[model samples]
Every structure is written in structure tokens, then in C-alpha cells.
Target chain A: MPKKSSSTKNLRSALRIDPEDGVVDLADYSPRKITTGPDSRKASLAALEDLGAELVDLQTRLYADGVAGEQRSVLLVLQGMDTSGKSGVIDHVVGLVGPEGTHIRAFKKPTEEERAHDFLWRIKRELPGPGMIGVFDRSHYEDVLVTVVHDQIDDAERLRRYRTINEFEAGLVAAGTTVIKCFLNISYDEQRERLLARLDDETKNWKFNVDDITERRMWPEYQKAYAEALAATSTEVAPWYAIPSDRKWYRNWAVGVLLRDTLRDLDPRYPKTDLDIPQLKRRLAPPN
Target chain B: MPKKSSSTKNLRSALRIDPEDGVVDLADYSPRKITTGPDSRKASLAALEDLGAELVDLQTRLYADGVAGEQRSVLLVLQGMDTSGKSGVIDHVVGLVGPEGTHIRAFKKPTEEERAHDFLWRIKRELPGPGMIGVFDRSHYEDVLVTVVHDQIDDAERLRRYRTINEFEAGLVAAGTTVIKCFLNISYDEQRERLLARLDDETKNWKFNVDDITERRMWPEYQKAYAEALAATSTEVAPWYAIPSDRKWYRNWAVGVLLRDTLRDLDPRYPKTDLDIPQLKRRLAPPN
Candidate 1:
């Protein structure tokens, strides 16, 4: 077993939005704020080296505990604008752990079959089994975010969906899934810069979605939709954390810290042996 | 882009079982053989650090290509007795690439639902999509190995399944999935030592199955089953590689090299864009 790396840092509370805080005002949150953990890019990267090791240990324990029949699991839901580095978190942060234990699903445009069902139908199919870390690149929240920004859903339906989401998450929490949702918040300027960078880099051309510019035109509408959706759905059991993500290093480290802390709190032990060790040891001897 | 680490070493050919060679004699193969790549444990570890960077690059390209509609993927099928370190390869080998691009499934015994269908029915369900790396810990081969040894299947049935597996693999290859099968072969003495070590360690007790002792008692039967299976199914399109796995470091590094080389061979490229760059850039500007 690796030596555990514990810290007093409470990234969870530092970044969490309280239910009473009500609708989040996008302007109040800085895209460059370092609320906890490392304050500089270099330090965050350096700290990640140690953090990665600690995460691997915790993740392994979680997987081990699950293999021994523990039913609990962790789910991380990452929601962000195109350039907010959602995929970056999966690569640099979750990349630190063993792939076998991490179940990742990047929700794309709804397929014909998917569109036929309720929003949570597809999401429910992909939930991680016991002891796994489930990551949603974009999640059921997209049903609210994208649809609302485009005015596809009416107020009555949108409000009803929020209530449905809350009930759904509450069920998940009751069934032993610790859900961590993060809204990777970046400034409008950051999105423009990232999109431009993709345009300039020929290698990144495939990632440049033309619709991103079309969406940028509705920036204000998106902010309104996001703020309202986050506020309504953020509950005590599954609150939303607004991560300032202009700095890629900070965003990656912050998510890594959140995962590490959650796994640490769960404190999944290597399960006790059900087998008779002595008898098994004797049986294991080579034939004479 | 990091400079590619090209090597003359063909670990694939060095380790692959030739179909024309007929049945493999386990005694003729050394469990600690290092046919290619780093010969020393420390050197293999160091090489893995560099290999990991190469793999991450290749895996990223493969994923990007898939995103751009390229339809090619890799499947690695791993089979061995307990304590042969199948999970170790997952952690130390496949873990080098990003989790988003790798799909790992460790097949336990067939559930009631799995048994109701054809053997390949469940296996087919887990096939990796475009640009993903699929790994099966104990795969379709188990039907031949375990059932045959336990007298559940006759010789005629075992041979028929081999033909079915070959055709299934040929179909997968035809559909752009490269299949690599590895039989992690370890000596009886090595298995004994490893089992004893597991029994000694309290933390690893969860991994120590009492059934492993029962399996070990039927070691010769398993060897016969494995050798015959490898011989019958090893084909030009999908060959079985008998990996010498007594040394955990060698086994891990060997599998890593297999994945790295396979990805390097595919050489997936970041896709070209369909959007007009200048027009998009102009539209990306914020309102004055």
C-alpha cells in the first residue's frame, strides 16, 4: 500500500454553491480564480504528480473494494462551453488513474433511439457499476443547457425537467453513487481565444466546430440558461461546483483534487478475505 | 509533436505463434523470456516512460481519427490462469493511453443471461467502436479451455468452437478491428510462488481465489487445452502470441510494446476540417 497523502484543503466546500446562494451570477465568478489547492500553473502541475499517485492508490482501493462486493461508486459530471477543457480533464486528470476502473462516456447529439426516450434513459444505461469512477464528458444536463439556450423547450417543460433531474439525482445518491458535478466556467474571451487557436493550428482543425461561432452569438442566453439550470439542480446531495477554467492547469488539478478527496472520504479498504488462507496456502503447494 | 521512437525490433513477429508451427509445447518456452524490447527490468521500466508518451500520442491520434469518421480500432485479448498478471497488464500496459480511447472489459464467469446466448453473443456486445482499444481479460477462449478441462464439452465441440472463433476474428478484422491475442504462459513453480505471495499479503487476499487452487490442480489439463486452442486458432490475420510472463515487469512491458507498435502501425492522423477558417475567425469576434 502507498503512503496516503492527506491535506486540510477542502476544495469541495471552497468551490461548492450553497442551495440558499440561489441563482449563480456568472459575472461574480472569475475565470481565473484559485480558490484552493495550487495557486500557480507550475505548482499545480508539480502537485499533480503527487496527486496522481495518491489518486491511483485511492482508485485502486475503490476498485478492489468493489471487486469484493462494495456497491458504492463515484460519478463526475463535467459541463462546460466548447473551450472550457472538458476533454482535457479526462486526459490529464482522470488519465492519472488506471483506465480499467474509470468508465467514461462523452454524450453527443441525441441519436434516433436516444431521442425516443426520456433524457435520463441513455444516462442510466451508462452509470458505472460498483467501485468504478464514472465520468460524463457532457451529461443529461445538456438536455437542459443546449435545448434551453436554443429556446427548444418551453418554460413549463424546462422547469419540469429540472424537478425531474433533482428527483433522479436524489435516487442516485440513495443508491450509493456520490455525484460530483462541475461547471467548467471560462470567460467569453477565453472561448474566442481557444477557438482561434484551433483555427490557427492545422492539426486541431477537426475539433473546430463551425456551430461554436453560432453558439457564441447566443452567449448571454447560454449564461442565463446555465446559471438558472445550475441553481435549480444544485442540491445538498449533489451540488454544482463552478470551476474557473481559463487556466487549463488549474482546471485539471481542481477536478483531480475533487476526485482524490471524494475517494479519500469513501476510504474503501482492501476487502477482507473470505477464503481460508491456511487451507488455500496448503492446497497451493506443487505436486510431489 | 514528439519525435517518433522507431525501432527495428519486431516484438510482434518475435512473440507471435506461427499457425504452421502446430501445437505449442509449453516446456519449450521459457516463462521469463525477453525476446524483444528491454531485457532488464529497470531498462523496461525506463523504456515504458518513453513508450507511454508515444502511446498517448498515437492513442490520441486514433481517437481524433475516429471522431473524424475513421473506422479502425484495436482489440487485445488476454488469457491466463489466475496470478498470471492479466490485471497488471491493464494497470501498467493499457493504462499508458488515455481512458477515453480505451475500452476494457474483464470477463468473469458467464451470468445466466450470457449462458443463454451463443458464446460470441456476449463477446460481440463488448467489441470496441472506431478508434478505441478493446481489451478482454478472459475472453471467448475460456469456453474452450475451462469447459474442455472440466469435461463439459467433447473434443468435437472444442474444435468447432475454434473454427467459430477464427471466423469471428476474421470478420472483426474485415470490419477494421485489429485483433491481438496473448496467452500469458507461466511455469508451475512460478504460479506456486505467486500464489504463496498472495496468501502472505493481507491486502491482496481479495484477489486470492480459493478456486485458483482447484484450477492449479488441473494445470496439465489447462496447458493441453491452451496449446491446442492456440494452435487451432492462430491465423494469418489474428495470431496468438505466447507471452513469457513469470517476470511481471517483462510481461507488462511486452504487452505495452505490442500496443505501442500496433498503434504506431495504424498511424492515425488528426483529421482535416470542412469549415472555412477565415470566415469563422471573423465571426468569432466579440461585439464592440
Candidate 2:
């Protein structure tokens, strides 16, 4: 791979979050058993709800402030292997941000036009406006991960594309875009189980494609691709945080916590207005 | 009042939508009512689910197609006052469009940057990308309706805004953006009753402001603004349809009919691809 810029190198270094970082990581570190501690399951549920409510309030304030003109935009890119719960992640994490400020764009197969343009072209076009939070279910990372793993592109070309992606993300960050890239890291066994469960449920048949597991067969290739891609592109401007996704509830909490922290860092302030309600009231309504 | 445009004059003269031909009048014509005639309620419930699903499908296809090089984009702007059931309209309408293909952007207040720019500036930034459908809640029309009714701006500014909005909408259409503007019209009695109901519910108190009713006091102003706004802005490119919003069931059904018809007109086709079972099988079942 070509040498990365100083900025890209810095981003890559900052995002190396520990295996157990906070309540979020702790909640998710173990999959089968939830460590609620002193809090009962009911209390845990309430706590999560409370966390969710706080997150919503913070996000709402950020949104209102942005609308009032702070206009700080955060673009969250979720990349993971099949059955990694990208959709579920979005449904739960973004559930905190009211629909008014959050914009979700899920990328599927490249259209004829998308195929025509550079891989990043389509994703770039869908970037959220200032003050809005855009969430991508799967993003341009697919170019480096899926396509590279499947040997859709030659190795030389894949390396060049990786550099291009690194540059592209750097440009986005330079332009005041906060890019939060998250990888839903689930064990292969857990993934197989989830896929099987989906297959078992008739209601979920629409979601299960046998091709997903077929892609999983290229597991090593994909893992290598993800490792290289993250190594190449996770810059100080846009870092990739790998979230343990075996536990769906914990995964949701982790994403929510990350979102809360990120928004808090932005510190969006509401716009001030001098509305003299008392005088206006006197003018509009005569006192008895 | 200024004289109507040649095109507006022609449309009004040719079509008997309003009682008054020359002057734009809200009293003359109300939104088309969706009477719960027989199976309407049941049909609406079924259709609401279909609406969301279809929207998702359409939105997904549109996004993909646009990235592929298609110039097609659809903007479904949902405009209504408080309790006009804008949320319900979105729930029912977007439900028709499956979650896959649709991108819903609910515009609340202007961000600081958005306010710095003109009213339509933020709106312009949020326009749907090609191949996907963008839904707006309380769009730029708020500049005219809310601002005017709430005395945010003067009469001259309000009239100037009408023409500017008309041109703005026309420009969007000319740029290959299909703008479908729908206004949910609920009656005074119905609105008052809804407000009373909201007051009765402790959970809903947060949504209610004493001044919200004060805005309602300017009902005639809002009605007049909407009438002129629609008349001035409605064009061959982007027409405004008034949907009766008193009955939730009827609102859903009417919205369903409109969306179903619009999507049918677009007639999105699935990508042509052959599923090779052998390839899938080989990938799923690795060689021994």
C-alpha cells in the first residue's frame, strides 16, 4: 500500500478504542449473558430507557441548535459482515435522534449510474446537509471490502482505490464533516446462527439470502480486506470503531453511547431570540 | 390583490377547482374528503402498511438508479399545521413506499446556518437525490403560512414570498426534481376538538403550548395564506393537492391513492440479474 498522509495516520491512531472502553463496551463484551450488576433486568431496562431518553434530549438540542444555525453535521458510516445487524443498529441507535434531524441512506448494489461513476461518487452525493446527521447502512466501504474480498477488482487497483477512499474521507473531514465509522464485529458462529434463525422464520425470509453466507465463505478474504481498509482509511478526521455485535442489546447501547459522546463533543448551542411576550400579549389582548 | 398570471388565469379558468375564478379563495374550496365509505377504514389500514413498504422499495430503487446515472428524483413534501396529522400522513404514505426505497426528511426549524440563508436554502440542501424519494414535513411553505399567520413578516414580504416560492418550485421541476406538495386541511371544529383531546392527555402536554392556540386564532390568515400559496405555486411541474385530514383513516387512504398513483407513474423496474444457484451453492458449501 502507498504511504498515507500525516492526517490519515493520526485518525487511524486515535480510533484504537480499548476492548472494554465504557459501560457500552462492557455491556457488549460478553454476548450470551448480560451483566446487569446490581440493577435487575427491569432496572436495566429502565436505565437503558433513561439513557435513550437522555440521548434523545441531547440529540434534539443538537438538532435544534444546528437548525438555529450551528449546522454541525455528523455522518455515521456502519460497515460490517453479513448478519452483523447494520439495519438493527440503525433502527436502535438513530431511534434517539428524532426523524427531523437524522437522515438515513442505505446503500445497496451499485446502480448503472453508480457503477458508471467512481465508487465513492454515490456515497458522497448522499452526504447530509450541515446540522443534519446522516447514517449509511452500508457505504462506499463496500468498494474496498465486499468488492475486494470477492476479487471483483485486481489487487493493484484495490490498493489504489483504498488510497482514493482514504483521501476522500480526509476531504470530507476537512470540510467540517464528522465521520464516525463503526464496524459491527460479530463472531462467525454467531453470524451463522442469526442467518439460520432468519431462515427458520417465515416472516424473515425476505431478509435471508443464501448468498450472504456464500459471501461469508470468503471470510478470511473479507477480514483481510476490512483490516487493510480500516488501516488505510481510519484517519484522525474519521476513525473506525469496531463494536462487538454478538449481543444486539449491548450493540445498540454502545452505538447510542458513542453517538451521545460525539454529539456532546460538538456542543451545539441553541440560538437566542428576544421575544417580548409580555408586551406582545398587551398589544394582542387588552387587560380586563 | 395583484392580477393572476396568464398561466394561473388559464388553469383556474379551465378548471373549476375553486368557487371563485378570479380571486384565490380558501373558503371556496376545501380539501377533498375521504369518507370512511364502507371498507375505507379497513382498506386504509392495509394500504398504510403497503404504503411504507412501497416507499422503502421506491426510495431504495431511486437511490440505486440515481447512482447508476438516472436523472430521476422524487420529492414528496408533506405540509400541514399542528394536529393536521402530518406524522400520520407520513406513517401512512411512507408505509406504502417500503422502508428500502424511501428517504424521509422531516424539517422542523431552521438551523443557524439555514436561517442565515433564505428559507428555501436549507430546503434546497435537503432535496432528494436522484432515484430516491425525499419526504419533507413542514417544508418551505412554512415561510409563507406560519410566518404570515404568526406575523413573523409583513404583508409585502409575504406576497413577495408567494412568487419566489412559485419560481423556486418551478426551478426544482425544471431541474428534473418531481415535487409533489400535499397540504393537509383540517376544519376548525376538528382542530379545536383535537387540541382539547391533546390537553386531556398528560403525556401530550409537552406538545401543547398555550400560544399554539393563539396561532390557531389566526385561522383565517393561515387559510388565506395557504390558498394564495397553493394558487401561486401550483404548476404543471409541481401541483399542490389538498387532502382532508379530519379522519385518520380517510387521510391515509387518500394519501395512499396519491402515492400509489405517483409511484405507478414512475414505474420502477428491478435490476436485471441472474441468480446462479451453482455459484451460490459452491460458495456456501466449500470444497472438501
Candidate 3:
């Protein structure tokens, strides 16, 4: 642990930031000026990898205790725009967690059955158990976003849904679930470039949709919806951390850090035991 | 891909198994005859890791396309008892998938809210998007196992729920969701030893639950529950594979093989595109 702390200290020094620095304000901090050259990219990737490994190790330790006690669980919710890299965050961060301890749910369009229930109906089922971590990619907030932006639901209904979501998340937090909400913010130009790249590349062509481009034209509406969503739902229990995601690498790094911070705050440790070596030798030791 | 195949062939050769040989009957294969020498352990771990990496790469390719298309997804369900090495399987296999294309959901005991809904209700929301892979650890099958064995519901309800689960799985299959269910079968003696070790070791004490031992005592009931679950749910659309899990290393290897087979069958490829370089350049090139 000392070695880890020292290494982090060195890396923080290299970043020329205080080791105790909280959120770096992206509003004023120009990522372009941050200069993600080869060295920086390598460092960022390494940091992500480090954070990922730590998160997994911590979660595993927590699960071992969790399954033993069968008493506690954590739920992490990731809310981001299309290609805000929600999938990437899942791919990178939870990727490190062992399957025994970690579970992820990626919510999509509502089915007829789902439509019959409240928007939160499907999500509540996927919550993590005691000693488990559950991740939601494009979670219940979609009801607030897509429904609002596309005018699929009336404004009154949408507002009611927002309150419902807030209440739902509040319930989860009250139940001892640590809810971490992240909003990935990618610049419109960057999104267009990525979408076009997908369109142009043979291997990426499947990702391009004319409908997505049409949706891109509604960026202002989507932005307004996002701002409102964040404003309405970012509570003390489940605050929204808006990640600057123009650079894919940075998105990965930021999410990893946030996860690490959250899990460390969890302080999961191996459950204590009183070993009886003599008794165990009689039970587990092979017959001579 | 050819290199991977040939290497897998070499691996098969080293294991001295016929290429056409299907999964062996574990009951007929004596455990005493199997030596757990260092060489064998290394070989098994290496093979599992190789297979896991291949599956990750394959899933990643599928996911990239899925993200582009937004229409296809893969649902992987892994069911096992404690210490059945589900984590080992996921750790090795998904370790290689890029951070953008995979999701995992681990089902725990129902919350107060979850218990209020139908068993499968929460699961429906967590389905993977097209091109993404969703892994469920101890999924809706629990509705049958826990409820049936505990007599929490009547036999008629259990049967109905079983049918409901099968139908739900089949629906997922029809909806472009490939369902691969894996059951890890470890012997009772091994489970007891593992649990005792968890209890004995201070580092692992948190994982030792008096309830796990209680559950272990209900082994016969659970076994019957599993057998019934397997019989009822294993279908052409989504069949269940029982992996011999007395050995953690072998369990990981077997699940990795199954995942590899499933992903390979999915055959995710990069979306095709006609990228006119001139057009791309005209779109992105700076205005002189």
C-alpha cells in the first residue's frame, strides 16, 4: 500500500497537480491545452489500468466478505449520451471486477412488458446483492432523456418520471447501495467525426445510422435534456459526475478514477477469522 | 484467426485429446486419476487464458459492430455455487474484451422491491444491446431454485415460473440475444472444505458464512432443484451446459471454451463500409 501511495504520488507530481486535488474543473480546463501526447497517453492508460486492477481487487475482497455474510451490495449507474463512452467505461472499469462479485446491466429500449410497468421496474431487479457490485449502462435515466428530447411522452409525464427516478435512486442509496452516476459529455464535433468515421470505415460502417445523424441535429434539445436531468437528479446520495469525454482515453481514465475513489470509500476488507490450525490440520490434511 | 486455431490445435494435442472428441463424461472420468502437478496446472491455466482472450477479442469485434448497428446483443448466463470458479471464468475470458462492449449482471437475493414484482421482471431491463455481450451471474433460474427448494411458492407456481423462464430465454434468443447458460458443478466435499478454509483463514473469514454451510446441508434439495432447472430450461434455443467444477482451474478452462465457442458462433465482424478517402478528406480537411 505504501508503494502504491508513493507511485501515485510520483504520477501526481508528473501531472503537476496536488495529490489531494479533487475534481479538476473541465469547464475551464481546456483538454486541448492538456496535450495528450504519447507520454501523456501512456501515463493515462497506465493510470486507468492501475485503477482498474485496484477496483477489481477491492471488489473481489468485498464480495468474499459479501457472500460470506450475505448482507451488503453496491450499485453503480452510468448515464451518458450515445458514444459518451458508457460502454467503454463498462468495458474498462467493471471489466476488472470478477464475475462472482460484479454484475452489469445495460438498459435499452423499453419492451411492451417494460412499458407496462414504471420505467424503474426493470432496473430495480438488477441491483447488486450484499457483497456484489451492479453496474447500469444507460440506466433508467433514459426515460427522462429520450422520452423528453424526442417528445415521446408529454412534459407533465416526463417531469413526473424525473421525480420518480430521483425517488428510486434515493431508495437505492437508503438501502446501503452506493450509487455512482456519471454523465459522459462529448463535444458535438467530436461525435460527428466519430459517427462519420464509423460511416466511412468498412469495419465501422455497421455503427453508422442515418437516424443517429438526424438525432445529432437535435443536439441542442438533447443537451437541454441532459442539463435538466443532471439538475433534477444529482442528489447527495447519487450525484452525477459529468466526465469530459471528447478524448476516449480521458473518458476511460476519469471513470476509472471515480470508480476507484468510490470503492476505496467503500473500504472493503477481508472478513476477520480466528484460525484453528490444529483442528484444520486434522480436517484438511491428507491421510499419512 | 488461423494462428489462434492452430495454437488451439497445439493445445489440444498437448492435452492429448482427439480433435473430434466432444465434452467428456465427468462421472466416468475418475478424479483420482487426474494429477494436479505444477505442469498440468500451468497448462490448464494457460489454455483457459488463451481461450478467454480469444473470446474477449471475438466479443469485442461483435460489440463494435453492435454499437454501430444498435440492433444485436449477446446474453451470457453463468450459474454456479459458491467457490465454483465463476469469477475465474469471467476473469480469464472477459479480461481481453475492450472496455466498450460488454456488460455483466449478478443476481442476488430479491430486495423488498424486487420481491414485489415477477421474478423475471428485473432481468428484462438488463438485456444487452445488439452487438454487446451481457453476462448474468445467477440469473432468473433462482426463481425456480430458491423458491422451489424453500417452498416459497407452490409447485404450480414453480412450474409456471420455470416455463416463464424458458419462454423468456427463448424470447431473448428470438430477439437476436444468444443465450449460453453454464452451470458449475462442484462436489459437496470440496464445497465443505472451501467453506471451512474461508472460515479458518482470517483473510478469508469475511467470505465464510454460517448460512453457506446451512445451504450446503440443503445440498440434496439444491441438486434436485438444479436437475429440474436443467431439464426444464435446457432447450435448442438456449441449452444449459454443466461444467465439471470440482477443480477451479478446469472450471475456468471449460467455461472459457464454452464462451469461445459461443462468440465464434456469433461471428462478429467489423461493419463493412465504402470509404472514399477523397470524400473523407474533403469532409475533414482544414479549409485552406
- Among the numbered candidates, top DockQ falls to 1
Backbone clash tally for model 3?
16
By TM-score, the better pick of 2 and 3 is 3
Query: Candidate 3: misplaced stretches above 4 Å?
Result: A1-39, A64-75, A151-167, A272-288, B1-26, B31-39, B61-82, B94-193, B211-246, B270-288
- Candidate 1 local lDDT, A1-288, one digit each (tens): 011123427677777765455667777666786656677889989988788888888877887888788889999999999889998999899888878788888899999999999999999988988888999999999999999988899999999999999999999989989999999999999999999999999878888887788888888999999989988998999989888799999898888888888989999899876778787876776557
CA displacement after TM-score superposition, residue A268 of candidate 1 (Å): 1.8
True contacts recovered per prediction: 0.88, 0.08, 0.52
Worst 10 residues of 2 chain A by lDDT: A19-28
Return the TM-score for candidate 2, rounded to 2 decimals.
Answer: 0.60
A181-278: candidate 3 lDDT, tens digit per residue: 77777877777677767656666565555566567768788877876677677666777655557777776776666667667777887765554556
Q: What is the DockQ score of candidate 2, to 2 decimals?
A: 0.11
RMSD in Å for all candidates: 4.7, 10.0, 7.4
Chain B alone vs. reference chain B, TM-score for every model: 0.95, 0.80, 0.84
Candidate 2 lDDT tens digits, A151-200: 78988988898788878888887876788888887877787677666555
Preferred candidate (DockQ higher): 2 or 3: 3
Q: Which candidate achieves the best lDDT against the true structure? A: 1
Residue pair clashes in candidate 1: none
DockQ computed for model 1 against the true two-chain complex using alpha carbons: 0.66
lDDT of 2 by residue, B38-91 (tens): 146786577566555565555555555564466788888888777898877665
**Residue A272 in model 2: shift from native, Å?**
2.1
All candidates' lDDT scores? 0.85, 0.66, 0.66
